[model samples]
Target: MNKRLLSTSFLAIVACLLWATPFAAIKIGLKYTTPLNFAGIRFFISGLLILPFIPKFKAKLRGLSSKSWKLIIQVALLQTTFLYGLFYTGIDYLPGALGAMLIGAQPLFAAILAHLMMKNDKMTWTKISAILLGMLGVCIISLGRADFVLTTTIPLGVGILILNNIVGSMGNVIVARDTQEIPPRILASFSMILGGIMLILVSIPLEQPNWTIHPSEYYFALGWLAIVSAMAITIWFGLLGRKGVKVSNLNTWKFIIPIFGACISWLILPNESPDFISILGMLVIAFSLLMLNYFNKKRIKQ
Candidate 1:
């Protein structure tokens, strides 16, 4: 039992690590294309990337029930379309490190939603305290930005990311609740395809359509984003369906994302650098994760 627990937790960490790369990758890709256009192409390709991995894929699609299909649509709409719509838009306006830090706020929203939606996932004081500390890290990092200003774009980007977290958390809970009938890969694939198509269609009227061919850097970023989305989202969905895995606990692994993402952004993005405040915020976030884990282990033992 402990072995299974450790394996699932490890896989969850792996998924978070993959997720960490997208902030910098997306920032790189956005330089060549518009937000919705870039996001649509990335996700559409990611959905396609998953098809080769599934065994007997044709038969599996043919066998899906209406409920499964509905769940897929719901998740695709919320998680992929709306979530990434806001994500791309927000990340476009903010620095990569700030964007990653804002996204690291997901566990707080996920914990609250899971508490309300799942009886088995009720909140504990330790969990609440830990989430609050993580949020503190987010605030610290944001406030520490050299370009920190009360500009329209700054607040708008922050608001969009907050909404993204809510929508993402809701999608996570829905998948956790109704994933019994569908395989995780199939759910992730169809939803991402449908959502990506929707975004592409919407982008035609909302944003300027791109026609020119791009350089190798654009393709590299896009390819990396798609590959990570396919692997990470599939892994995350699988973990969401695993028995005895709490949504809040699984999402807590995401704390590592901001740390890696901020560091990567500082290293790769010419405009980004690590400040003492940002590093301190990351340390606080790491300490909160440790506290959460210690409390969780104690709960399990009890």
Candidate 2:
């Protein structure tokens, strides 16, 4: 691969890994704080932390049209504030395995949204099969952990998570569009900061959260997550904006998150063990990824 592709791959892989392990932190942080407010505090601090370092970021903001600002705000609303709000709240009420399964649905939604919105990313049967395999692998992995309970009953939590996936997917599609107007870093910073403010606004009336109740570990988790968010968000925006990149292709890498989540859970939490079934699920996920990326690329060469 070319250097640019190599760099993007490295960044994308690491970013997904970072994104993968954070659900534990969010779950832990929620024990001491309300979901919405905790998310707001974490993302708001993330935006603050990211904004100052890039001096060139401000120069890129000049002369942006009103429409561009609107687009950025829409991204912020859907991607950060609304998406995370539903996510944190929904996960709070569901079993962890089920929640992971639902969250794993995001790439499917993203791929569908990309197919609908971006002509260049039209779906093929191969991509569809890959999506299914990846999702099934996730289900198997979660099931191995005793967290996967298939049910048709749509509870409030499931409803919220469904909406969360849709909104998050749409936001990703929006980001993937080639507007060529806003710089990626500036866009990332604005959406995060603004969306975070919106989350805080909602939290005040609905959650009225107590920020002071948590011990030092809570803050440590929150801080680590904030830093990860800063890195991941910026890298994602950069990747999405890169020429010739597809939203679906990048989102598929998110399947790796479950592998990390399962492993990390076994390490961090008591009673969680690495079982043979989960290991099998991990292998299936790897094969699915190879079919999606490697074989797909090789097919083009033929």
Candidate 3:
């Protein structure tokens, strides 16, 4: 492979693997905390952790333009609040692999949204085919198992996760426009801080907001997730701002996440294992990403 391709692949792998970790971690955390409360505290702490990296944190805050502030809040509400409000809750009812797999479809959604919203990134036939393959991959996963019986919770969980990804896709579009205008770290910090606060407020009413952790696993989850949020968002947004990377191209890396999530879940969580059908489905999902990203790129270059 070319050196640049190798480097890009490495970065994408690292970022996606980091993201993949949170599904199982959240599952562990939710045992001791409600979904909302767990998500709220994790993001809030992560946001705070981002402050020391800023050149002049306090001065930057004071100097922020009103437009910057508004963008920050808008990102907070759309990216963090609305997206995660569904995600953390939805993941609760899903198998770790399944949930992560669904979220991995995000690029497909983003591609469609970007084509509709951004003039340059039009929906090519290749992209449309890629989107259908991705959706089919999701369906295969959802429809897996000869014994797979549908339940209210499972269906509801799927619905919530789908909604979560849609909101997240929209966030990507919004963030992509202003990515160069604002620092990724600053945006990650404030948006997370504000969104975390919003989630915490919602948790107080819905989940009573568990303030303590007894299980060591809950602490692991919280700490890991916080770190993931801080690091991943910073890197992810920074990547999105790169001159040639489209939202879909950058997001193709997301396919690796479900693979990591499933493997970790199977290894650590005794209760979850991938069936043959699900394994097949996951392969399909992974291939769809290749179709959208790798092959598409090759064709464009050719």
Candidate 4:
């Protein structure tokens, strides 16, 4: 049990770290193309990248059940299409710091939804407290990086991001609950491809994107983003399908994303640097994870 816990935790951190590095890459890619268009291309390549790794991909694709296909389509729509669509729109209305902060709140929403939706994932006081602590850490980190100014659009952005979190949580719970028979890679591959196509179709009418050649930098960013999506998302889906994994507890690790993201920004972006508050926020997040794990182990022992 302990070994499984440690292994899952390690993979969770890895997945979150991969997720953390992509913000800058997305920003870089956006410089060369529209948001939905770039995202569509990135995810399409991500799905294709995974295809080569699965043994007998053609047979597996043909063998998937109608229920599996339905699950895949549902996940594709909620997780990738709606989630990213709202994500880009929300970010447009807020500062990057505020956007990151809101995005970081996903785990909180996940926890609450899991408690309501899954009998085994009921919310305990310790769990709630720990998640709240992580949220506080997210806020501290965001505030440290930039000023939070209130504008008229703030409410709209916050609402959209809240919806984004809820939709994403719904997708996570569905996978954890309903995808035991499906291989992780298959689920991720099909969902991302379908979702990518859906995004591109919508982008054509709305974004009016020009199909033009992009610079090497843009391709580099797109490649990295696709690779990250393919690897990290597969790891995540695997984790979700593992026995004894709770959607809420698994999602708590996402708190590290903003911390790692801040560190990455400081390293790569000239305008960014580590500050006292950010370090303090990192410490708080570290403590929160400790609290979460401590409580989890105690519960298991009983």
lDDT of each: 0.85, 0.85, 0.78, 0.91
Residue 237 local lDDT, model 2: 89
Per-residue CA lDDT of model 3 for 94-139, tens digit only, reads: 7755775577678788887887777767777777776667666655
lDDT of residue 119 for candidate 4: 80
Q: Could you report the Cα RMSD, in angstroms, for every candidate shown?
A: 2.7, 2.4, 3.4, 1.9
Tens-place lDDT per residue, model 2, 1-302, is: 67875576677888888888787787689889888888888888888888887677656677678988999899989989989988878887788778878998888999988999999887888888888898998999877766545555448788899899999989988988944577787788888899999999899999988856678889889999899999899889888988878888889888888888788888988988888988888888888888988756786699
User: Taking the candidates one at a time, how many backbone clashes does each contain?
Assistant: 0, 0, 0, 0
Candidate 4 has a TM-score of 0.96
The positional error of residue 124 in candidate 4, measured at the CA in angstroms, is: 0.6
Clash list (residue pairs), candidate 1: none
lDDT of 1 by residue, 1-302 (tens): 57865587688878877987876677778788788888898889999999999889999999898888888999999989999888777876776557766887899999999999998999988999998898788667666764544556777888889999999999999989887679888998988999999899888899977859988988999999999999999999998998888999888888777677678778887998888998998898889888998898898899
TM-score of 2: 0.92
**Worst 10-residue stretch by lDDT in candidate 3?**
141-150
C-alpha TM-scores of all predictions: 0.90, 0.92, 0.84, 0.96
lDDT of model 3 at position 131: 66
Instruction: Report the error of model 1 at residue 249, Å.
Output: 1.3
How accurate locally is residue 292 in candidate 4, as Cα lDDT from 0 to 100?
95
User: lDDT score, residue 257, model 1?
Assistant: 76
Over 4 Å off in model 2, which ranges?
1-5, 148-153, 211-213, 299-302
Query: Candidate 3, after superposition: displacement of residue 74 in Å?
Result: 0.9
